[model samples]
Target: MTDVKPSCLEGIDANGTDSESAVERTGAKPAEMVRFTATPEKNGATVESENASQLDQATLMATRPNGGWKAWLQVACGFSLMFNTYGLINTFGIYQNYYTEQFRFDPSRASLIGGLQSFLLFFANGAAGPLYDAGYTRLLVVTGTILIVFGTMMQSLCTEYWQFILAESLCIGFGGGLTSFLSPTVLSTYFTTLYPLAQGIAASGAGVGGIILPIVYRELEPKIGFPWTVRVIGFILLATLLLPVLFLQPRMIPGAGRKFIDKTAFTDWPFVVFLCGNFIYLLGAFTPFFYVEVYAVQNKIASADLGFYIISTMNAASAIGRILPNFVSSYIGPFNMLLLSSISTFVFAFAFEGAHNVASLIVVSAFYGGVTGLFFALQPVVVIGLCPDPKLIGTRVGIALGFISFAVLASNPIAGAIQSRGGFVGVWLWAGVTTAVGTGVMSVSRLMKTKSNFFMKV
Candidate 1:
């Protein structure tokens, strides 16, 4: 720690006196303590070392797993809490069609609602991080569950486009933002090695929600109406939120919070780069998800039995996508999976955009949904690398996800505008190119953080 000294060997004055005392105390030879001499200008300072092995113990506990029933239970809580907020939003296409048809907005205008929903969901990420640090997990979860449940319940009353946007898009987006922050942070806390796996499993809840809701909505909405369909979904989330409150333990480090940044950390070049990458990724992400059902309808594959079943199919594939890449991510690192996920984005953005009919749209949905899930899965992991302190993980995630919200708010409407101009072709082209650009940004992230390509980490 000093320029003048090499650190360990310090001079002791009359060291033989100390050595003799030590030898007499232990009944050992008189030379048991070593003799040392120091010359002037070659002077050394006295140093002391304590053998308290327990001082840094909490740091290890905070990052590494305690590895038992309690931790896994917390993981399960994370699964329930996360799976709904992140996963259920995948069912967006079904709701998209419903909102558009009901509100009678033009396609470009209708698409903005989807963008707004996406924005609210991610925007919540930024606010909840600081709140979680200040307020703790219990307060956030309680507040989030109430907000989400009330938001969904309110969706039934949406009679116009603005009404739907206000109730479903903005309120639910706020709800999602509150709920999303808890998942990876909870899991990463207790099971660093197993975090990706936990994250994968937890995120699958969204997939499950996506699959179940569309089918349920398609069948039940005609019978009971849109208001009730959303009410049921709210009820389900209410149940999901309970398990975490009853069982999940914090494992929070004593006095650890808000440590990742100085006031200038937001201005730090690395975080700015990650934010840009996330923004672009999110910008390209929602077009396919928001449009798949419409694409199906336009292509003449309508069915009472299966009109919105495409959302379910995509959700199923995405369920696996979330789990698999996460398992792979543990060994290869999060950035590698993220890079591959981004490439998958370009593939689907271009491929699905061209689908003027049923089969092509389905192909696009399945492929795009899978990668979307992968991107969702990896974003949390990638953000964690930017800030190492456990206390600050929530904030880092919030910032990354907040940018994603901004991107989501803009991307779909942009794609919609393009579609309005030249039909689906121009829009899909824009989607493809947007994804390709996002991929480039992520490649830069890999370079700055670890200086490796997606494959080399393997």
Candidate 2:
């Protein structure tokens, strides 16, 4: 259309070809206008209109959103990937049930195991952003699959707490983090204004996985034992994601080449505020992901099935939470969407404090999970809003997430310690307060971006 290809993948690929490649044909003279009888139809024309509709079809294709067959296929790949990684990760409650019984570890100590896994997942993704920008998607995806497969295989042999620390916490954490960061970047690079929708679609994979994996593990564990049950899930991930990598393209303009994001991009004020706010909000957000179900079991109000369901339900709700708000956001603005989600999260945390039964607990899990799910889906939009350069996007998000992972690292142990001393109310109240603090920080961060201006697009 513009004689320029899309820059969806911010960093360009080095080996791509265009008309310029004809110069190296090693002929004495190069033809100025190459033509052939066997040439395929130009990209945009519909068959019915033939030559007459070529320009019009080109314009329509140019204006199409990034949800082409390839892009959505990538989203499906993410769904399969996330289902395996997140489903297993959220099943910490399932693991925790036996972990305590088998190892005699206290809740506080066990929280560290789950906490460390989550910390690596989020924090390591900070680095993953840059690696992805350096043209590493295929590599990371393959590596992640290998790590997850090997980790699952090795985990079946574990007998001690530290074994999980090595196999599950570190291996799975690094594995998922690698895919997690790249998956979003891949979705965003292709989808322009429709990024939030695409991202919501991709992010929903984890939610589906979270919902299905717990049920799968729960049903299968009793019959097959933990080792084989876990190993079987590993193969499923390999099966689903292995083929799609071939169809995917980086979407960079032809002839453009890959380059790392500049460090100067990180110094922007809006990005800095985003970093801080995300750290505050996410630190509190991750606590429930890792431990809310464990709280249900510890409080003696619900059975172990309910504990597993807490996260499972939360994950299910999160899928909706991530995708549903996108339509409203197209009108209201993503920042507004984020602000409302943050406030609702704070409210949900407090609501959690009064819960004592399955119904109340389910509501808390669903609502809170939904609120946080929105945060993840749109937070990247906030980053892109602040800094629009594709080459620089990775740096800004990487740095922001790196800081956020610190809070992720610390949130659960804090929750576990509080639960130890004062039970669910104490931990939930702290979590609620943290959410409010995060909301306030995120709002202020936005204000800083707009020179104290509100209702600005970012």
Candidate 3:
């Protein structure tokens, strides 16, 4: 029998012990270690034998394709997935408006349709993660693509509330959740050193999609009518989604006998704390995106025509924010970037309420989108860093995002209630306060992980 020391396990815990010990401490069954030591010398394989020194594992990690045609192609695959999923969700407001105007439906009821879609978009992540770990990448992406395309087509024919809910919310949202979570999880396996940068580039697709899709809707609906315009959007998604479905592949082996729940992840204090901080941050993170244009129109700071494009401007700026900060994060560490962005976001939350003019409103929207965009891009990378087992990245991140889905679902209604009672100022104040608390929580998590080493890159 080949003797592999327990001390040389795949992942290191916060206590400086190997992941084997951490797994034992958590009472999880012994999982298969990474095959780095024995795999052939191709792609990411290292020449080190199973009996080689602990450096064997490190060598395997260092062999990742940081930047190459194949690796960059994977990044493109991730971008396509993001564009088809979250990017589509970003344009829901336009559909909500159309539904309310054409059918004279209650605004709150119409909002439910979009809210349900957004909720399931993340909520299905719990199952999505485990499925990915089990080597179901193609299944998830293929099924999700079919659902989204079919749902969009069905949405064109719907005239009733329940029909829209079934076609638009349930089908699209659940499909999006299944596919969206795969992007970061897959990217983590391809480029260890430039993971954050690659992920940022992929995530920028959301901002790009956000900017373009709404424009497509706004310009097309007038010229082609609602049904054909939606069909056109569906065609765009179909063309884009086919790329990821055909090309995106996982670089790592499937986890052998991985569990669905992954309780070991929750046992880690730093990860637990970080997960809580993320949930709290999400509770208010989307308030500005949700209401920036509303604030512009209601306050008469901008005309409806100009206000229509405020979100587009914000999303365009966010594309820059998503890519540039992430490139820097590769050197500074994702955790450090997370803290900086969280603090900046808190400041911007308050600044948003103080904007009393069109120029100021547009500027605040731009800056806020940039800051929050950094947070969005950094989140999955942070989750991957905190996890002890490389195999658990998908499950743990899925759990983290799935937990936060409730916050995204309720964020708008909570802000609306505050608006009714106290107006936009109260809403902004709430956003700032929640974000500040979340930042403080993440700071504590960082301190715990680094053992108070202020200079540490982590």
Q: Highest TM-score among the candidates is held by which one?
A: 3
Local error of candidate 3 at residue 411 (angstroms): 0.8
- Winner on lDDT (1 vs 2): 2
Pairs of residues at least 3 apart in sequence or in different chains that clash in candidate 1: 83-206, 87-206, 88-206
The whole-model lDDT of each prediction reads: 0.65, 0.66, 0.81
lDDT of 2 by residue, 1-458 (tens): 01112222221222332223323432312222221112222221112122322222122122223666766876666566666565567767677767787778876677677778777877777776666555555666777778877887888888888898899889988887776665565565556556677777767877887777678788898899988888877777667667544433343211123343446655666667666777777756776776676678777868976677677788989989889888676566667688899999889888877787888888888999998888877887666656545545555566666677788778777776787798777777887888888788788877775666565554
- Candidate 2 positional error at 218, Å: 0.8
Residue 315 lDDT (model 2) = 90
Ranking by lDDT: 3, 2, 1
lDDT of 3 by residue, 258-376 (tens): 79898877688988998888878888889888888888998999988898899999888888888998877766778889899999999999998789999998898899999988899
Runs in model 2 with CA error above 4 Å?
A: 1-65, 253-262, 298-300
lDDT winner among the candidates?
A: 3
Model 2: what TM-score? 0.81
TM-score per model over all chains: 0.80, 0.81, 0.88
lDDT of 1 at 277: 75
Candidate achieving higher TM-score, 1 or 2: 2
